[model samples]
Target: MELPGGLGGNDAPDGESLPELLRSWRNRAYPREVSETAAPRRRRSGLTQRELARLAGVSERWYGNLERGEPAEYSEGFLDRLSSALGLGEAERSALYLRAIGRPPTSAVAPGSAAAAGMDLTLQQFLDNQAPNPAFVTDLAWNVIGWNDPLREWFPWAAQQGNQMLWALLAPQARKQLVDWEGSWARPYLGQIRYARAQHPDDEALASLEREILARSAEARKMWNLREVHEHADGDLRRLRLPCHRGREVSVRIVALRLMRSDRLRVNVLMESGRAVGA
Candidate 1:
């Protein structure tokens, strides 16, 4: 979707509005210090467009267009980098996104005045309540936010790996623990990310995760480049090699549920029978 980027003067967005806002933030990023008495004469230090573009990992021409409030595709990546370059806080980053993309970033959600707390308290309760079975919760980006003790006991890597997909695809422990690692774990987890990217094309964290996966694993890159989009772990049976059982494999079925409050947050339970499966 092409956003209206008419440099603010004509009427809809008030031409100079975005330009002035970006310029103000740029000045603040590199402000000239002044004494109490000298504060009266305090002024902005020079922060050229070229310098900002270099810092933001964008071309000078692209950033110049943004500074002038002209029409251009301002991606979430670009906006994130720009926010970082200008040293914007949560609130500032939210405001920048609102101005740039007509909506605040999915990651930088600030309700009213303060930044959002990463996870909901209720999610922990949900995880703990699901005892015996291995259960965990992940945010939209598939970052492992919360997990139950049973999960930590079964999938020990859950304690160290911050991201679920990253561990499934990149961690050496994953190959040792999951039988048929490629067909069972990697493909399904990547499928979830592929589906998410299709749904929210502007999610910066998701995009970054996909980029990292492609860069690190050739197998992942091949499957990803195949462009298959319908893989998901919910209801799929997977063979899990349990450490306590002398590396015996067990058939575990994945049950995924979206948290009632947020579709982005999911509760994943790995249900397994007491018996082990064949090799």
Candidate 2:
């Protein structure tokens, strides 16, 4: 099926589906870093989602639905509540706005979408245009070898975080910082990992990364054993609200980029709205 908003295209090899491409995309969309905030962040700051709703002046149901990534009506009121509750900054607020419409704030050029053998400057320009959005270039196994500065500026730990699927999950700080740690994240993350495993069973690097993450994190270990399969690209977008500079929340859209050059790897781009363009 053609993806919504021209997402997945119809150019895969015979018998290869968009879901397969999505799985490849998900592997590329690995988290930059585990949240490194203190445990107090999870304590809700002595406030509940309900309280945040009340403070933001929106209904609890509306707020809850947003967190779940459910399809629902969104209004300015709800955005205000989410902004206040999640501590979203101006840029993040705009990102949330774009996601509410089911589209990323920025556009990405897939690798190999062009005729060149190296990184495409046009593609790089597209990524560059997505200023204030934390986008990165990665391999099929989710190894982030390069990224724009906004990515590191927004999530400093990303640069230092081990570039692997499970390592980011195993980190305690990252675990605490995830907006929807279990449901929106852990489950599908492992699902994609398994999907990749099926494609590259003999890939020693992936095998070793899986072992390390499962060993270090009980949460990751439990999720990995489920043996579930999910294609990461199926137009699924995760609205992640992380604390950025000065504890301000920066909302971002984590999307996948399928490269044309190396089918073995892809770039995961993080984007936000409402910030000055270019980074």
Candidate 3:
């Protein structure tokens, strides 16, 4: 939590109060961010502690005490409200929760929110260069943001809606191509969605996706009810009925990679376990 102008957190002289979190909060712009203000100036200025407290529905004294790092019981909900009031970014809010509560918030946050719908050229080129091998990149919510042509031979719809979970669970192509669509694809993906929904209960998109899945697919509804959950299919084996192999059964191992810059960006490369001759 570095302060502006290279000032340390405890660099406050004599009487003027410039607490650590207070300084951070004072830099958050919202509600009264007039257009004429320069970006640097805006970054250096924001809501007053009293104004912020009012917006957060708390008294100035309470906000001051908390900002001053006075030991007080802080609830996640309260911190969440404060975060909303301050218009904090996801990382900033998470840091605040950790600082105040000694733990990160339990809310399900999209891992690569900083790069939402972003396609990195290095990653895309890497995927494109992985010829013959099936490779692709997906965001935290399984949104396919990048892929190779080889992957398209496996999943032609990857570039369509760009959501792997939806494609695996509800797409007609998945039913035709994925071996044992219920056991192999739908159920597993539904479990993943279920886990995501549980972790991010406040996410309306996940909720809406869950509803659409339940409404469109009977198998998904059943699997979702089983209460199964897993983080991801990092090293799972899956069989596919390949069009490239003239509908022959092929087995592949799933290899999952998280980017160093953003853990939420998943790079999945399929390693073939078994091959079938084209009929």
Candidate 4:
């Protein structure tokens, strides 16, 4: 008997059934070689549904429902995981998302303008000019792509670490440098990451970084699962103990500027608040 939405039947729609399309793509993409002497089995040599489900980090039943074309809301996060598991390229990924959601994947990132071109030179000058105030730039994933000399001098760890999220959430030195690490820095940073994840569900790099943090740090994992979100505001206060000044604690005004030309790049500057010492 034919199943719903043309399962195991020729009476399927003119367009390829989503299940069949996924199966065919999976079979072709992950072909397994059999011994030459032995006759190949009737079934295609590819990952089993269970294996695919495992790779996608979904329950086997949910994956089965998806293949069966069951009527259910497929979230972007689920689609992203499935896409990553199947190793879908941009085109295939977009198609899968469209088919599943009846719309294309949305990116929070905006198109970069001419001024955003030559990112290295532009970012270098941007940082260099913010002298005295520690300044740095990060990609959407919070990777420290560029920084100024003051930033390097103020926070040596920032120069050493590639990812700001990882540095704040996982670095041992961060706990020492930031006062109230969990309350002030780690939790808020994790919340920002959660917000970013929601904003850019299709960003595989962000997903991978989150996974790495979850795997490596128990604190980050706990904070991540909380599902909190935060948007950093300009002129916020951040307290840090600068090692260069012999453990002198300073409060700085945070200035976060999003580059209009590029949605992915942002400049973070910390200006020292001219307050009396220990006042």
- Backbone clashes counted, model 2: 8
Please give the lDDT score at residue 85 for candidate 4. Answer: 53
Candidate 2 segments whose C-alpha is farther than 4 A from its true place:
1-126, 245-250, 273-279
Checking candidate 4 for backbone clashes, the offending pairs are: none
Better of 3 and 4 by TM-score: 4
Tens digits of per-residue lDDT for model 1 on 1-279? 222452221223333366887888788776322111223444457456765765554457879998887865576655765665576776667667767767767764422111232465566776777777788877676656578888887765454324677667876667887899988778777887899999889866778778867766898998887777764578788888867557587888788887566777777888786522111
Give the clashing pairs for model 2.
34-174, 35-173, 35-174, 111-259, 111-260, 112-260, 112-261, 140-265
| lDDT for 81 (candidate 1) | 53
Model 4 misplaced stretches (Cα beyond 4 Å): 1-118, 275-279
Residue ranges of candidate 3 with Cα displaced over 4 Å: 1-115, 274-279
TM-score, cand. 3 vs. native: 0.54
- Candidate 1 positional error at 194, Å: 1.1
Q: Rank order by TM-score, top first?
A: 1, 4, 3, 2
- lDDT tens readout by residue for model 4, 117-155: 225786688788878788888777665657888888876
The C-alpha lDDT values of all candidates are: 0.66, 0.51, 0.64, 0.66
Model 2 per-residue lDDT tens digits across residues 191-232 = 887888888898644565566566557877788788887766
Winning candidate number (TM-score): 1
Q: What TM-score do all the candidates reach, one by one?
A: 0.57, 0.51, 0.54, 0.56
